[model samples]
Target: MSVTGPAKPNFAASGRRVFDIEIEALRAVVARIDGDFSRACTLLLATRGRVVCVGMGKSGHVARKIAATFASTGTPAFFVHPGEAAHGDLGMITDADTVLALSNSGETDELLMLLPVLARQGNVLVAMTGRPDSTLAREAAVHLDVSVPAEACPLDLAPTSSTTAALAMGDALAVALLEARGFTAEDFARSHPAGSLGRRLLLHIRDVMHGGDSVPTVPADATLGEALVEMSRKRLGMTAVVDGERHLLGLFTDGDLRRTLDDDGIDVRATPIATLMTKTPRTISEDALAIEAAQLMEAHKINALVVVDGKRRVVGALNIHDLLRARVV
Candidate 1:
């Protein structure tokens, strides 16, 4: 006779248990932040050179992210694999730099082996570990205890909650330093020039607006048929109705054309474009940011806008498609 096997445990329930435990562990870690945390921040802030973050195993992943966070938030920092450092990657560190080393056990052999040389190089060493009294912590100038009650892993051997706590601490450090240095969103955007926020902040309307030959325009006295031809030829779905001096008088769009067609009393071919055009149409300045242009389009429920100069004369035109192509939408 075959024996019955034990029932399989609920995998979802196990996952929830792990998540709950890690959440509590993170809360405890945050509550433990005190004067040492402040001192650690002060040490990093006082340093003149880049922050060299080092770690091994899973902690290494957290170290790399932390270094990136610090770098993007106005702190000069980069990650150095401790194992690689022993074989000459240590050359990246300088006498003016500060080293942040991560080791859950606080006695990582590779990290401890390099502490002396790093210290001799005059680099300030900050150790983050679970054991405050470990040799690595004792050798460093500052010791940040990232000790957790226990690992979230049922086996209690994997680095789970501990790594999460370390990551959170690193984020806190970067944000605090960011605020301390008064690093604004513009500064952050400069570091990430290829990202959406960079485009939004750095790109001006004039940079993307259609000017000169591309701007669909017609004189105020132009007939509606002339305006429609200009709009269709330019393909911007709109035309600027300007005065003799090129000052903006109004705007004519496909929407207005549709409304005029619906009104049987109006004749698109005979009526003057200015009579049917929208007066006081939403507009933006050439100096405005592309993000502002996007906002204006969104607020007015229109797809296109006329761009004017400081003197309120039409200089350019743009549509929602322009913002999308420029990655500013």
Candidate 2:
């Protein structure tokens, strides 16, 4: 005999129904955000140590993500599984830490088992539970009601809407704390050093620019023909027009060559680069951020820039390719 279920359900309809239920569940959690939410923020802000997140089962998974978000957004935090806490991970929790516990029913056995220990350690326990009157809620220093109207699951047993509510509430807390602490993009980049955002925010123009002898430069009085040779040798497709002391005067590029070719009586070999180059060319400081260099390229509708020093002297040169190679683009 084979196990047969109800008529093949329409996945689309089922999914839509689930979305609708979860939306209402999310809406319900908003009204529950009262003075208790404010108190939880206060406790987290005042913590001398990390924010320790604890939960079991599905809530544990949510707890892990919450901890990660908090840590990355300027709040030092980590997750400790409730079951693991019973087996000695409880030592990780300190009296200076603030504990954020999650339990949809407010009666998870593993979490309840750790209540006395949490109290003994003097950890500020902020409970995110669906049942406000449950044991965990009653024991918590601050209770965030995560109750929902109903589960999106047809059997009302799977942790769907409740998990969504808890996750949203966690996000609310992280964002609130982030704003309170004035966390910035640079601060986040420090925490995510290996990510693309870190590359954009931390890497400076000098780090990737072609400097020293690699920078192609021709004296302002040098002929276009001489500039072309410098451009070819450097392979940057452009050459800076500078004074005898390397002070930036203008820029001549491969495109400038083409435009010069169209004009009458213009000899690439004889015409001074100063006469053909784009005067007052766009330039950036070598200490400027690579992303700033990228923005300059986009804003000016150009591909190359002369990297200058405090004295506006040409110290290096870079093109959009350098920005791309550095992954700033």
Best by TM-score: 1
What TM-score, to 2 decimals, does candidate 1 have?
Answer: 0.95
Per-residue lDDT of 202 in model 2 = 91
Q: What are the per-model numbers of colliding residue pairs? A: 0, 0
TM-score of each: 0.95, 0.94
| Candidate 2, 26-133: lDDT as tens digits | 999998788989999989999999999988889999999999999999899999999989999998988889999999999999999999988888888999999999
TM-score of predicted model 2? 0.94
Q: lDDT of model 2 at residue 59?
A: 95
The CA lDDT at 138 in model 2 is 97
Q: List model 1 lDDT by residue over 1-329, tens digit each.
A: 99999999899999999899889988888886888889889999999999999999998999999999999999999999998999989999999899999999988988988988987899898888988999988988888888888899989988999999899989999999999999999999999999999999999999999999899999989999999999989999999999887899999998988888898887767899878989999899988999999998898799999998878799999999999999997
